[model samples]
Target chain A: MSQKMTRRRLLLGGAATAAVAMVKSSFGKMVQTGIPEAAMDPTRQVGPLPGVLGTRSPFEHPQRKASLTSSQTPLQDLYGIITPSDLHFERHHAGVPAIDPNTYELTIHGMVDRPTVFSLADLKRFPAVSRICFIECSGNFRKPDKETITPQDICGLTSQSEWTGVMLSTIFREVGVDPKATWFLAEGSDAAVMTRSIPVSKGWDDAMIVYAQNGEAIRPQQGYPARLLLPGWEGNTSIKWLRRIELSDGPFMTREETSKYTEPIKDGKIRQFSFTMDARSIITYPAYPVQLQKGWVEIRGIAWSGRGKITGVEISTNAGKSWQAARLQEPVMDKAHTCFRYLWQWDGDTTEIMSRAIDETGYIQPSLKELITARGIGTGYHLNPVTAWLIKRGGEVVYRPEKWK
Target chain B: MPYWACVAGIAMISCERRVNTAPTHFGYGRPATKQEIAAKAIAIRPDGKGLPAGSGTVQHGAVIYAGKCASCHGVTGTEGPFNVLVAPDTADAVPFDRAPQRIKAIGNYWPYATTVFDYVRRAMPFNAPGSLSDNEVYSLTAYLLYANKLIDSSTVMNAKTLPGVIMPARKYYVTDNRNGGDGPYE
Candidate 1:
């Protein structure tokens, strides 16, 4: 029977008769269903109206890969340099707090001529500045040993945004910061009340008190009302949920800087306050979980440096034996993620492919072996090495794991 | 006006602003009061700048540790369902190493002893953070120090004594000098 006739029959019959008919129809031959008439006729249905806010399409799904303490951005899914504010990587000591912007106040004290408290309104009144930069966690490296991992699994803790706020220097000058003050502590308002002692030079340099990200109010996970933006530094140093700035003469030696973030180097010496994120790059295309075809393939990825702009990116389709320069997307801003692409035709051969980033300072991204030899086995933080992807003859792309030691 | 004169005038004004001792400030935020600063300032420096006036003995800390910290950190503060805070006596004196058997207890990894007090007062008890009093925080610091064998069990921890108590791992801390100049170190 037709679907329309069946619906009419169900409406006409009572519960007992309908149950008998359903059983009788199931025992008979099966029938195929076709498209509904409303779908083909546009005038029969009405579309949704304009909304106050926009949302991504239901078909498109870009999600952060989360763990117990942190979540990584979907680096492979992202297209451009600026990461969507909602999809930005998050690493919080405690969980995110629900802070009310109307009642928010950021205090600046310690070793200053005049300690000051700035409201959100007052912070907005200052000369606002916007710059595109990446905030990379010092512990962003993940050694992938499986074929199921994607680019997001390898290293997705770094994210770029067009951050907008008042320059910390402007606020420092307003608060009459003393020249004798060498360092200032940035404290968060989260449950952990995270704190880090940042150098005074950074405050006077490119540091900012960011309230807006990616043309919108900062997300709660990304520190909603306000956060400190220390360009080219470790993400932890740029404290989210920034509530206080206390200038001091020396380092705070907090738990984060001491027991947590610090790592042992060669000769059993611990390296502390290693703020700057080293240059690194990962090939997003031809990554794991995505099968490749034997044809013209455009290898694409992102390369960034905390030191300066990414000058060049070298791609080696045949492993690390030889490398050729990949074309960088135009307008590669300083300390921002720069898109890179290389055109290659695969002969369906099983080989390893990787990319190395070269920064303006002439520093080449090192291999895992070289990094381990320099820092030794105990080192865990700031593990930025060239990651490789293995391409199987059957078109399966897998992560080429290296000796973490 | 002549181009040269205009350029000279602009340069003089810039120079005057730079040299001015009392420059026009941005004057955006209100001056924070002493009370306001004290209420929000919780960070303790290595030099004991923010250490409150209080003292605690290891005897008191042991009781507090058993009740509050032992559930997460082990009973002796070393055996951990969480992070290991104590190390065995047979372990290497300098525990920072590439060897497979490296123990990063408070006695071996932490560079500053005062950090224990600051961390406990700020984010301890895990469930009720920032709930510990200055005396309790100091006691916990002393207790952990004693447990790690960094200090005597009878030693009282205070602002004056905590900063002077040097950590064994303090000598191994070196400032990061990676300038992106060359290989792996960069």
Candidate 2:
């Protein structure tokens, strides 16, 4: 694999701390120091001893760009399905809260025969189930009509991880949920006390109260002690820092649901409770900020859907006139991000390239124009359009800007 | 039969415990008390199921809005550096789906009146959330509603009347229509 690697070495922790104290950047800033340029090649040198935790190479700074309410993951730098827990995109109504795992307790009440409180340890004692899935924010699409934008800047709110926990069905059984319950309110413990009314069917179907993410305790930013994980649904429904679950007969129209998540449809109506993310794909390579060479280039990207597994991904080399199927990387799990690639020999000619995901439900990823024709450009949520990149004959690549019509 | 054995592995769950038909409660947690549930039960439904018993008038709310909320929501509740709380022109008459600007606010977009109370009580004032009293939340809800012309100056916002104060935009809300198929994208 040809790595777009930055210049090297970052010394870290313990003995490196003292060594880092000696180094400064060109501007006289106290930058963490690595071995001198002479020692850059690792083949001849002995590495330092292992520490409590490992750190990424100092040169590799794959990070999330943070905003007031959300952060975008650096999609171009990632490999495979599982997103590094730290690099996972975050969307929170309130900032991450510090909660002690020992004191963490989840209260399940309302419309249940036996309202109960389970400590974190008590929860782990129940049957554990782990599954890999992608959690994409319904509002992951952002096309600002800029050609200089990277794939990370376009749609980086989606991320994947193998979450481990006890199923909500097991918890419901433990609490003896009432038969009349059709909906349940999931409440977070953050300052906003963020709440969402979820269908009871979702709980019985595939919901979980997850504590471990990608194998370890979930990071505080991703909800420390525990969170509610609803596979294939929008990220907002998976209430982080989950504190309470109240079963009810109808939906509780909270501010997030009514004022925020709802989208404007074709008519004068507002579409509420639109939870699933549509099938979408974007070619990371040969995309903006990544200049390309003429010969053999493999187009690579990720495709996922809330409905089911990604069945196929069609690649268009000449701006959507015709298409060919890309190779789907194996171990394609349900409702998870699946990688796709296609080999192409560029002839040093200026052209546009794009990819569209087709899910098991046979839902083909639509273009920005089609999305606007169907849902209108009024609502800024649930947009998953076929993204294209304009490859210049001079080996420069840029995003083909699509205006929100 | 070993219940733990059946629950240990997802692949090894063929044990009769999986077919208990009626699941045996694992008894992992203790019964929650009413106080425990009520302490964190702050969410208010559209039907006012969880609305607190306090009351506030538009006049009283204006005072609270000026002191605590005006810094972030603007003194008039319309010009916001963050989110505009009031927009009277874009009320029930405006078809948001086709509107030119599509500037949504509490009056034109929000469907539930109780949400004002619920949201303010949980997250408001910007500097310090969940710091508002029940009376203060009611006052702010009334003040914002009054500013949006959704309620009269004399109208009191409380448990009994909050739910009955039907929002104009409530009629336009519908459940999701997209069923993910070969059909057209809705």
Candidate 3:
């Protein structure tokens, strides 16, 4: 790895190179006008050196806003679906545990004919699989705040990663799960000893025991050594620092399931174990804190769902009154973020623009009013209302606030 | 000669191409092992499989509750500035839109008795969690059940007997079936 050049250093180098070029080009009108002199000065540069550890570009910096319990992602600065491993959102109860990979173990016991304990090495030795999926917190929405708040602040508790791990069914087969068992309790090794009861059907499906993210060992903030990966499910269900899985006949109804994850619906009935996230989208560029131009502008954003593919994403320039389908970037994936773009002819008028996601299930993303009317104001979790960006005639963009009551 | 020098400089600049080489070494450690995995598998399931061996009566549980839990949860587990732990079985009553002005106790909302034991043992007592012994937890579970009128005051709870008691809120709880198609549920 080479020493990353900071913006200040690059600017200084550019100035010195310009002075040298000026001296060299006295007779002719400096033939090389656009190209920087640094491109011509070979002797001034150093060769590639090895042995340097991982690092980010000194000129660029993306960071998370850390508080007592959770950290918000910087969604405004990101350009793609894959979040850098370091910038992934975090929400841990009782703080992250420092587990030595050598000492870490995953035990599969209870209601199984063959109880088994898998060392970290044992899990890696099995057939490994990798898939890209998003893990979003059950409580990921916020009230309309100041214009400085990015999409990350609005719903940054969600993130996507190319997770590499053994299929959970491989471990389940090794343990020989009992046929009668319907649910399994997944417990974490954190200080709070976080735990949730997941259905057995999920274990046999797309669930994974992931150990790596983004082509490297998982970041400590994203469950260092190993974590459960329930594709497209609520983030809480994917327990980090995973240590135990016990098969059983019924749900554990843990504190998280009964008191926390459960959301109240239209009637008096509370929606418990509401796991999968509905389809949703957000405009990345020309959003809050980004100024727009008057003429033709290209709008880019991401759309995704837990149910299936994002078949279509509709953009509304007049606060969802008129809808036009945005061009879906090719190779749209299931339970993974799909990039979408729209070429809009901006007339420089003050207008509210928003995007609504329609998944393969044909379920249209609800507006804030529709969501409140359906779920009621008392419930705060699972809030996925379509987000609106208010673009001013002066080329400034701001978030449009939606009142609950 | 100057033209040749300019061509050589362009060649050197173009040669600075980024390589797609495989990472020969990693900065982080390797994966976790089976023995390490076994040291922490303490979760209990609904089928009474992972439950530890212990037994306690409603009478014994009442004493433990008074000594350890009554401060925050209130006497008899009814009053609370926090969550309520006991109530009469009202499976048929409509749930309040807001968390009721009165306490919506565990008997009214909790769907499984196994959860009551699993939760109390894992995180409870407000200030301290994982402090109660298995026997003590079992006794408190029985006491709460008795108070909620689900079990008799004389009932004893253990690994076997604890899962057998039916919960009032069990019928209302349904598995998520939202992925298949469009409806109020899916």
Candidate 4:
């Protein structure tokens, strides 16, 4: 026999006012935000009339946790790969500047045959290409020494989006970039005037001047008029609110490059220009704050690598004693987040579930213990360790926090 | 008709290797003027290529620090409402990578003195950034250097003497050597 269905007829081709009034009389106002939104019965009601802009359902609320310098995406609440534009992670030294497209201009000068200034209109006129990729902050890891934490609280700085823009190499060719120019300084228009010196080879290789994100104009939090998009690098190198490009022979050694972003490694050395984010994977479903029921369960997560495509992800249901390959979703693009899923029959035993990703370059994500043995305890940036989620017998889930000295 | 068909057939044959038809230049932007380039080129390198002509003394810097910077960075630069700016009992002698607990302040971790001026000029005071004059920036730089015990109290900081001050952490810096493979992490 077929499953039972709701008995209400589907409403169509009628004025929304009559349906809204009828629903309001029965249910009384549900939401008090002036629009009588969500004031309808769940099983049967006429939805709001079509408006100019779309809004998310009143039942769902996914938001980014913000601080003074940065904000983290709601990774646990998110599903699939592409992050919503407004919900994408943001990190600004000063603050997002309100730029008018008519007055905004990006100037490319120094070590070029022709120095030129391109307005937003000028950049849009060039050939545009779109691709999906992830931009992760170098300081993404937070070893706060606590067991109670969510994925957003642990590592929410990584976000993926489909960006549309003209390739920076196209503009480089138009300006006649000099062969001797090895480095270029990219600067922002914010109050900090953030600057970073990137290698010139990245321009010829997949760098883009992106202006649109996820099928719409880019949000001001991610750069409104334009921002630099360096695929497979740390997010800061992809400077937002891009204003200037100055080609040169050497690194500018700005305050960002020398004092702040650089991380200390083993021995007496400090690592400069560590751009690529390594392979990382975190189980989002069984993570903290989500209660589990012991039965036939499906574990799901996202895996990504800055160097190349994620080849495979291994799930360890019985802790680190053994591992099995999880099934990968189709159309796994290069340098983009790929979703993976695995099926397991939980025997109501308290155990830890974990995931580790392997990139196309055969670099496997290391454990926190293995990372500490190699890079020592002092290294801070680019911390991409395999994360584990602990499941309790009473149907409680929590993050498996690693101890760092 | 046969002649035209033969020409079309030849065109199809020529498409075997997908001949490159992309233009070398699309010419989308206008030439930038000298004035516009000068207005936005604000990055200052370690070799001191962009410092404006200004001089400041440590005496005047103390007064300016009390008025503008003391609210955020503390009056003595060591006690911080935010970031501690001064050195605490010669913390530079401790190797930061080896010692995990050492706090990174301007007195220990920064590799160049020019960065101090460059950062203050671009973003500082924590409230109203980019509001300090060049002379006031130089003065604050002098006061901070003196507070960190890197410079003498009588020294005058200008574009010339500022770059010459050697930071202790300069020699410890190295380029990133990490290459992704099955090898050990760098």
Strongest candidate by lDDT: 2
Q: How well is candidate 3 docked (DockQ)?
A: 0.13
Better of 2 and 3 by lDDT: 2
Model 3, position A307: C-alpha lDDT score: 83
Q: What is the DockQ of each candidate?
A: 0.63, 0.67, 0.13, 0.69
lDDT of 2 by residue, A1-405 (tens): 112121222344442323221344599765544465444555444344333466665456787988988998888899888899998999998799999999998999999999999999999998899999999899898756788998888999999999999999999999989999999999999988889999999999999999999989999989899999999899999999998999999988999899999987777889999988888898988788988998999999999999899999999999899999999999798999999999999998999999999999989999988898998767878989999999998989999888766
Question: Which numbered prediction scores highest in TM-score against the true structure?
Answer: 2
Candidate 4: tens digits of C-alpha lDDT, residues A219-303: 9999888999999899999999999999998888888888888887777677788888899988888888988997988999999
Q: Which stretches of candidate 2 lie over 4 Å from their true place?
A: A1-34, A38-45, B1-23
RMSD of each: 8.3, 5.6, 12.5, 5.0
DockQ of 4: 0.69
Interface root mean square deviation per prediction: 1.6, 1.2, 6.6, 1.3
For candidate 1, write residues A1-405 as lDDT tens digits. Answer: 444333322111221221111121365743322323234342332322333454453236688989878999999999978899878999997789999999999999988888989999999998899999999999898764566778887788999999999999988888888999999999999988999989999999899999999898999999989999999899999999999999988889999999988888888788899999889999999798779999999999999999999999999999999999999998798898999999999999999999999999888998988888777777667888998999999999989877655
lDDT of 3 by residue, A26-69 (tens): 67442223335445453464322232343343236677878877
Worst 10 residues of 3 chain A by lDDT: A6-15
Which residue pairs clash within candidate 4? none
**Tens-place lDDT digits, model 3, residues B34-104:** 46544455555566655778898999999999998888887878776456777644755755444433235
**Share of native C-alpha contacts between chains A and B (below 8 angstroms) recovered by candidate 2:** 0.80
Model 2's A-chain: what TM-score?
0.92
List clashing residue pairs in candidate 2: none
Docking outcome class, model 1: medium
List candidate 3 stretches off by more than 4 Å: A1-51, A143-148, B1-108, B124-129, B136-171, B180-186
Fnat scores for every prediction: 0.76, 0.80, 0.23, 0.73
